[model samples]
Target: MSSHQSPFTHPNDSSYGSLQTPDDSEQAVVSEEDQEPGPENADTDSTFGGSLLGCDTDTLASYITDYKYENGRQYHSYRDGEYWGPNDEHANELQDLAHHMYLMTLEGRLHHAPIVNPHNILDVGTGTGIWAIEMADAYPSAYVVGTDLSPTQPLFVPPNCAFEIEDCNMEWTYPKNHFDLIHIRELFGCVVDWDDFFQQAFTHTKPGGYVEILEHAVTPVSDDDTVDANHFFTKWGETVIGLGEKFGKSFTIWEESKARMEQAGFVDVVEKRYKWPMNGWPSPQHRTHGDDGGKSWKRLRELGVWNQLRLYDGVEGFMIRLLTTVGGWSYEAAQLFLAEMRINLKDFNTHAYLGVTVVYGRKPGLSRTASTETSSTETGSTKTDSSGFTVHPMPKSNFPGSYRGMT
Candidate 1:
């Protein structure tokens, strides 16, 4: 694919085709005008007219008014309509911290791909565009593009990096086979069609280019019996999985992504799994030789504390409205459930953890032949004996979104 050749043609000179709601359940016209505003389009509702995270007015309004606010947190008001995730200042701050968590999980590396000296990089669903900015700074010569629904990204990004308002579910407009590396993360609920998403990724990837997906199971897991079937955390997971099913998307994407990549014709697919401890009980990194329980215990307690704090607001920011609006729970009921969930998170004895999967695969080269035998591999070792905080391998027979035993 030529860098100069575009993959999609806009329906209108100043706008693309109508913006389909996130779940593809509805449609509305969303202007795709240039980010700059001129006198002719000034004050038009077709474009955003107010300052949003320092984004230009036109960029702010380009999205359909699919926005809603609850409890001081802003949310995407588009279809599948239950994204309780926030796009406010606090959310952005948590995103930055979450980026650090990802780095820590990956052992301080940005990504695990072997690509070298690539010029073009695309980050799909690049919330806050923090990864793009950091990648741009690291790879000075590469032009990085971050695409997302909201314009909450910083205005003073590196010159090599730029942000675009895009829906990953739609036909991408970038040149096919142009990006050296494409990255997507935490898009569990937003994408309705995983197969098409991977197909598009394959099409836009340069021959021999790499695409990586970083996602975690939204459902909580516990190796020990501490997290009972009736526990609030377990119920919360059930509700989230149920909601994903109701909307036709799957929340347990990481569990099925490897097979999806292979099905999409990607080669050399590799998957790595990590554990995200809900509290300090499952973290082996924070332990050391027994002192008087002063420094080590404090550090471990801090880990648990921060995880609790992040989860407290994070779960509310993602579930309160989702449960009330989509799950038919009343506002008061949602609040009560959230309060219980927060308390459960604070209880380190539960030993709950979420599985984080990082998978990367390459587009086959024009001259290379696809091998049918053992085309992919999983590098993550299953640990079931580590202090009862095990990270189980995804079952080979079961995939996400099947809704088995979720109710």
Candidate 2:
């Protein structure tokens, strides 16, 4: 599948989820009926190839297109049976670890240099709004907004925290020459357009304001042991890329963020890559992380995969089995893999040389910056190196991108 824009980017594997029906299972997955295309156009495109039922793109869109805000905080759901969650939103090992990592990013700002007079901040595809809520508490002076499509968020939140139910792939609604910082984490590889997304950020940002993005270098940056050519994660990544191209997204938008930001007239763009060990390994750094970090990594793996696994359930019949059965290994194996992943999360680590790429840029002080006018058509492009892996930019302008690219 070319990384060109389309709507079949991710796969759907729910057919087998129903096939594994136990005689006494309680989660009544309606096997006979196909996915009803939510509240929108459920009546239209009702049939798959006029009769079949697999990988219903329209249906998936309708299912995830709800984001609401109330009080001060935000909320979202992990599609219980589909992908991840029915579990606690906050206070989890993985979320806690994620929070810790986020806090590290905030140290320079939160405790060291207090954010003052900042006009606005954005949390793209804010899942549970946990990060935003925390930031809201930390920076009560700024208006922090989170956007997502699911209304499964909390009705009450921090005084400064607000949520919006806007599809980021569409036209951004914020005024131009606004916003101080835009923080988006974990939306890499799935964002549809890097150019437009960065362009809007540049336009909205107050020239010196920063835009920080934290994303895992999933290609597995390693020192001693590189990611295997045929590892499960690699294969899954390829599958996701193929599916993303089919679904109007590229699903591999991590590599091109810096370039896109530069193109959008951002300056002082800096990239920080870090190795994340799969588990606390033989190295002292790994030892320091210990079980405390390992458990958090394990949960992250489970949630990340589960969150997007259901999208494939619509097309591939055996897909559900592949993910839940064979793909679902014992906890021990996950621990090992996660250990390696964590070690590799950083650059030039003693244990493993793997790391995530943390990139940020300040919007250019262009006096005549272009306005955020959404694109009418979706498009994409990517670059690759010696390895089979490649990177593409996910530009989110005012609109004309996938509303659910990062969902």
Candidate 3:
């Protein structure tokens, strides 16, 4: 296991004091005395209100087409049963919310890979196509392509972005050595053979291009031991893990992705981990106590609320089909289990959090070697290396960009 410290401060820390209930809107508000001096002045109200299940009018104009109905939920018809989650309005809304949570987690950066001015980018399993659209806008010079099993992406996308309905597990039709960066997010339990997945990624990536993956741990844990083995959340996690094993697609792939990428001939593989508090349990006092990726106490509190909401919105979509088909549980039995799990999910006192890991690697070539040699002094400036690969300095903005208003 990686020795990365949990970004959360211990629950027993005196600064945290006691857990408090969030406001009726499910937003956490800290008194001025508890807040750290910072430049962010956005309202503390939850961004989740107003048209909760609504999609952008310009985007997703045809998201309701060609879905298979199951247990009152909608699943993708193409390669149906290949994936466990649903594709209906509720599920799509949850996916968009999850994307917002990821933006908050990453502190506004779309990806952690160091690649710059990528001319060709790909997003694997681009649910709802939110991230791909953002990337297209971020890099107007790059032509972004998003692939998925369903045509759930927006019809009205940027000119530089396009969506393809293709099952990634099958043989890829993309030209070999094509993409500048391949981004894969939250595909846990959707892939049967990760070795083949990375191999395809390696082959399709241009020499010196990068492949980046972002996945969250299915199981929730507590640093202060507040959630024990017998907890309902723990039991739910164990059930999901066992179901994945029976389904022949393990949910624990995030742990082994780095090694798989390296085996696929990718080099300079790097892994970064983060925490998503199950609810608004962490207080403002924790701001000074731990490594929270430099997020403010207010930001962490908001992230906690959003994380909890996304999980609550997604638990049934994540488990229903898997439990009934793979685990052989009756629909009623699965619903009963999910009810218990949801109860634990709403408990702020538990102080549990899910782990998010990002692993990235580069295809080896002279260009990649040249990228390492380039250096930049200006923030957010782009520099071209000897082999024509652009190197961009990471942005340092604390405010979440582009999607902040949508959140």
Candidate 4:
């Protein structure tokens, strides 16, 4: 790639790189289910036949036609005027960088679900298809399918992995009781109906399967009260929540994901919350011990830098759309307002952080006792038989005082 090449000049894994400014002629095409034919049709004809799906050009266009452009970036117009995020190449690359940064925070793994040997996986809102690709690599036997409104995934992927253009708000096309693991991430502003979505997810999930939701609380919190009532970040969060309410979506849905999953008939629902520092502020609690037995100041600083960078590059795209489309602010006014927000983002002394939550639930099947006993025996428990070697037993399941570890 050239020094001035776009972050998406080539198809690759989710990793960090500087995003180069695109020229006037360069743009990413958004795919909607009901777009009228135009010049993009001709462009699609020449650009999509050799894609990973290996379908004809017209067939590919059929999958990705409805779209609108803003700030020289393409966005999905599927469901006609819904979906708040962009589907452009720059946005895709930024999303991939965020994904990679999140993997670093999670030790390069996807989720905390205790699923084993899952044979069928579904990745909802699979931006860049990086998670699906990594999952396919981790489980070669699993058939991984990533679905999104935009067809922005790479053309080449693992044999077991595939990408589909589908609006999750609409009816799912996959067969019922099919997927062994259903993973959803970072869909705060996209999904309109949580009940309908989870009901469909429950119906599609196989018995004993798991559905995991990973999302970050967009509000930034400060420890020493540096982020006050007048802060732009705080106001930004308030505006997002208010906008979500007006649009019939909830930006704070992750906070109640466990209860929602349980309402959808999932069992053993567990929620884990993690924190990511917005910047390096020398906070001992947020600091990590180095591998060489010293304070990992450099690592912490890098994480802070990446976190701030991801936010700086990301906020404008979504914020502009929100302010203009929903808030009814002019583009110039939105940018003028966001300028202060960007300055606040660069303030390292604030010691701010974002709360990330990972919620996992199992489709109801066996009783908790049976499931625990089966897991305990499979994991080599202390129970033994008369033989010299350690034996496995279906020990009588003992209920615990608290359902902490059992879930």
Candidate 5:
């Protein structure tokens, strides 16, 4: 694909701004004031109780193969109501789109752990199992295992890759100190207790193994201040963060995962941050420069288009249940709010972007007795992997995409 083209875009499609610069005369810049009004007085105490199955573990285990249907979406029955997102085909497609977006952001690198010759790899909450399948392909010798609450993964995968219907929130049954790398991505609002979650990762990861987490901030922001606190899109983010808090699972993982990893007895913790523009807003810069300097801008525009498509396609599956169950909004009210949010999201003038943070840390080697010692001595030190590639701290930028920043 060309640097400026998104894989999701068709050759003749102009809706994604494939043929236009950011400042094209045809492009309309809709200011927040000019946009239609959002839903007002949304019922915060609507009588729409959620569709949570209040069954015990034994009862759920009997029908673990079943899925709960609500709001025209399917959710995992194993841990009903624990996750806000759905497990249906639409959700799965969005998951794959997100996987591709992450690849685009990382420049096609599956991971940043610098792992060499991994023997066993574990992908937590693997969703559709695309990453695990790719990893299995990348390392034929390595046994790749993907665990998720839903059995949405494809039946045919690489010989070395396997999918398990499991929930990461519960106690893990995997062997201790086994996996060479434990990879997690985009599990922001799903996790309730991150400390215990990372502790489980630490316990299951082998000595000197690595655990990597990839999460994007839930809120949207703009460097040029085009989007403000009162914007409907901004309110959508604030509402999601608030719902997460009410559900006891904060959407602030991007800001908290690094420290949580260190506390979980992992060493060499590092965080790399990137930007996911909300739309093709950055494409104009590419056309303006028409030089090598425009390459990065072009790539950003492509990524932004992908990001916008994913979010726009995923808004219903993402917020329907949360609005009704956690936020106590009626189903109709939730739909109205989501409709307004979608309209705001389509505004290219907003120039909003979501911040992505990839945090990776290594478990202490078997020779090390205490994690405190490792943290004090080698916390931020740059180290070279066996492949002789130096791992340095990536540059940081002033992008506010986290829940804390929204506040």
Candidate 6:
């Protein structure tokens, strides 16, 4: 099929359209002339003003008295899936590539089955319901639940797996004493109050429960080789962080989350990290390109190009203001920038520390607690075998990716 052909029409993905939420769910109208003062906009009810996150006016008004979405380049609305989910416009090959990379470098952590079977499990911020669904399939005896703010989950679910649409920001309302394993992955924008959220998770969990959080460690990289500070992609990380803060979320949530879990009195905390390529090329020479890595790059292009337009249309004000008031950049100019984003998504040369980290804390068992009745450490606790996969500790150097050959 031609690249332009609609993949939605394909027999396997006929429900893609129905599954995706339409942009029509809510639309923002930005007018420079009628702009309200920031203090007034934020001081009182902000029903008239708009939020960058997808919550409607009533929802925003109920929480923040007055909040504007502007943080960095992108504004509030851009975070919504409709605004940024343009990944479909790119070649489907990239989509497959991303999934493949996920299966590879990303999926290894999931391969290690728990030495002990968990009766109840929670997959926090589960995307596409893939991991949760698979886990359900693996431990059919376990009750698996996946939760997200957006109601984008498929209607169908395995008998053991259930998906719920609820904000992780709100305090967890599960029974006071429940849940054996709580697993969260790639919840970059989904978790706002990591401290409060995890505290609640700890409380509801059974003694001997397990909590796993997987996240990406994002810090800027610098090399003797001068790269453009203004390189849009390089600074794009801030956009990801900015949008998250607007929604009361944390992109780099590991440190505080650990302290919170420990404060909740959980024992046996362990953190493991891994690095993966963002693009197909491993080095300047491309000497060792994993077949799957090549495919992952194609998916990178598609996922990226769609994100550009989303930032423009999704943001609450920044994009609208730049185009309307400044007149410095035209719509055509914006499209060109987006085109550049697509091109750079596959660029791999300078090393980037695109590493994945998993932090786990185990809920202590009642019998074990009684047996110890003293120290809080798990030194005497039974240690399970590491998830039968290649594991690496945190990178000593900042640039962990192998893209840079000279290094």
Local accuracy of candidate 6 as per-residue lDDT tens digits, 1-407: 00111111122333322223228747357576676768545433345333323224335323322212322332122224212221221222332333334444543335331324556777776645666776676666778887654333455777888766455666666776577778876565456566777788888777877787766643323232322566655665565555455545556764355666787777777665444443343333332233223324434333233333333344323233333323344656655654554455445554332445567787777522212223333333332223332222211112234421111
Ten consecutive residues with minimal summed lDDT in candidate 6?
1-10
Estimate, for each residue in 1-407, the C-alpha lDDT of model 3 and write its tens digit. 11111122222334333323456798657787787744332222234212222223212323324577878888987677889999888999999888888887786778888776678999999999999898888888888888787767766788988777667788877778888899999999999889999999999899989999998888888777877998877887798899898888879976788889999999999888777788888775432234346566667677788888887778889899999888889999989988887788788778787777889999997444324456533334566655555566553323446544223
Per-residue C-alpha lDDT of model 2 across residues 265-308, encoded as one tens digit per residue = 87778775444443333333332233222334333333233322
How much is the lDDT of residue 216 in candidate 3?
Answer: 84
Off by over 4 Å in 5: 1-62, 284-295, 366-407
* RMSD, one per candidate, in order: 14.7, 18.5, 19.6, 13.4, 20.8, 16.4
What lDDT tens digits, residue by residue, belong to model 1 across residues 1-407? 22333222222324332332255456345566634556534434344322222234333354433467765568764332534477877788888767766665554467776565568999998989888887887777889988776667776788888877677887987888888889998898878899999999999988988899998887777666666888777888898999878767788898899999999999989988766667767345433232112233434444445566678778777776667766788888888888888777777667676777899999998422222221334336633332333332322211133311111
- Tens-place lDDT digits, model 5, residues 55-172: 2322444466578998888998867888899999999999988887777666566887756567889999999999999888877788898888776777778888887767778888
Q: How well does candidate 4 match the true structure in TM-score terms?
A: 0.73
User: Between prediction 1 and prediction 3, which has the larger lDDT?
Assistant: 3
The best candidate by lDDT is 3
Q: Give every collision pair in model 3.
A: none
Which 10 successive residues of model 1 have the least lDDT summed? Answer: 398-407
Arranged by lDDT, best first: 3, 5, 4, 1, 6, 2
C-alpha lDDT of residue 150 in model 3: 73
**Measured by TM-score, how close is model 5 to the native structure?**
0.73
lDDT of 4 by residue, 1-407 (tens): 00111112222332212233457589655566556677646334535433324334334354355578876657875554577778877788789877865665554456667666578899999989988888887777888888877768887899988877677888887778877889999889888888889999999988888899988877877656777888767887898888888777778976878889999999989887666667665455545323212325554555567778887787787677777888788988988877877888778767676777788899987312223233232235443222333332222112232311111
Candidate with more favorable, higher lDDT: 1 or 4: 4
Against the unseen true structure, what C-alpha lDDT does each candidate score? 0.68, 0.47, 0.76, 0.70, 0.74, 0.48
TM-scores for candidates 1 onward, in order = 0.71, 0.51, 0.77, 0.73, 0.73, 0.54
lDDT of the structure predicted as candidate 1? 0.68
lDDT for 63 (candidate 4)? 38
Error of 3 at 92 (Å): 0.8
Clashing pairs in 4: 32-66
Candidate 3 residue spans exceeding 4 A from truth: 1-65, 284-296, 368-373, 377-407
